[model samples]
Target: MNIAIVGLGVIGGSFAKGLQAAGYTNVYGIDVSESTLKIAVDQGMIKKGFIEANDILQDMDVIMISLYPNQIAPFVEQHKNRLKDGAVLTDVTGVKTTIIEKVSNILPSTVDFVFAHPMRGSEKQGIIGADHKRFIGANALITPIATNKEASLQLIEKLYKEIGFDQVTRVSPEKHDEQIAYVSQLMHVLSVAVVNSQQASEETLTYAGNSFQELTRIADINAELWSELFLNNRTGLLKSIEHFEIELDALKHTLEENDDERLKAIFRQATNKRREWY
Candidate 1:
């Protein structure tokens, strides 16, 4: 397959390398930066690199767009005509409802856009941080619409698995967003909150333990990208935040009342619920 990846940033670069590792030699990359494209080609992650979509869109059998949430729809609209007939297009956007609706409306009948979210990433940014190994043991979620072809959905799932994802599950776009808001976005928010809640001190790390370090690792985030993700899924994320706040308030009340039994019960409940994931 002639696979083309748009936006040769961390995720895109990782996809290129992973696909090549899986023996897909016909991979290509498209990016706005000439330096990024040159680096991608020099590193042999892609067979060739294009600075613009018009240069390679027509020849690709599969197009994996690894752009920001806001950019996904526009990129499709701009190059929808250029995409090859019968091509399978997919994206790695974190939030999906708006993007799916917009792209689905504008997509050509000949092509299929299979919406997918690879549950893997790094705190680091750009192509420099790309690592195909990140997908190992990670889960991937596919939000397929009624119009999506079964063959195309299967192709996407197979590709993700071949590139190292351990599992791929299909769910409604609404469910995907709701779950992600809690599991992914809320985790990041908590990390940031924990980091910011600390008093500023250069010596803070000296007192930190493994748990503190691990918990705040994602606090070193891509602010602009995360801000967009938070805003795009505002409704779902707000609901998640409200739920978390309620739990936090209950804990605070328990502490105020010096209710040791209640605190222990709460901890036990949490531990039991968490153990189920394993």
Candidate 2:
């Protein structure tokens, strides 16, 4: 298959490497940065690299757009006609509802857009940080509409599995966004909050332990990308935040009232829940 990856940043670059590792020889890359394209080709991650979408779009069997949430629809709209007929188009966008809806409306009937999210990433950004091994044992979620072809969905599932995903589960776009808001987005929010809550000096981090380091690791986030994700999924994110606030307030009340039993109950409940889930 002639697979092409658009926007060769961390996610796109990683996907290219993963595909190459899976023995895909016809992989191509597209990016705005000439330097990034050069690096991908030099590293043997892609067979060729293009600075922009050109005639190469016509030959691609599968195209993965790994871009920011807001740029997804616009990229499709701008290049819809350039995409090959019957080609499978997919994206790595975190939020799905708005993107799937908009892209579905604008996308050609001949092209299949199967929205997917690979549940793995790093604090680092761009091609320099790309790592094919990140997909190993990771989970992937596919949000397919009623109009998507069964063959296309199967192709994506098989591709992800070949590239090292442990599981590929099908889900509704609404459910995907809702669950992601809690698990992914909420986690990032808490990490950022934990880091920001402290006014750190050089000595402050020296005093930190493994737990603190682990909690604040993702706090070294790509601010612009995360800000867009947070706002794009704000409705679901806000709901999660509100729910967390209620739980936090209850903990605070327990502390203020000197309810030792209640505090112990809360701790026991959390421990049990964690044990059950993990």
lDDT of 1 by residue, 76-101 (tens): 99998898999999999899998888
Q: Write the per-residue lDDT of candidate 2 for residues 21-123, one digit (tens) a residue.
A: 9999999998999999999999999999998787589899999999999998998899888888999999988999988878888989889999999999778
TM-score of each: 0.97, 0.97
**In model 2, where is the ten-residue run with the lowest total lDDT?**
196-205
Q: Which ten residues in a row have the lowest lDDT in candidate 1?
A: 195-204
Whole-model alpha-carbon lDDT for candidate 1:
0.93
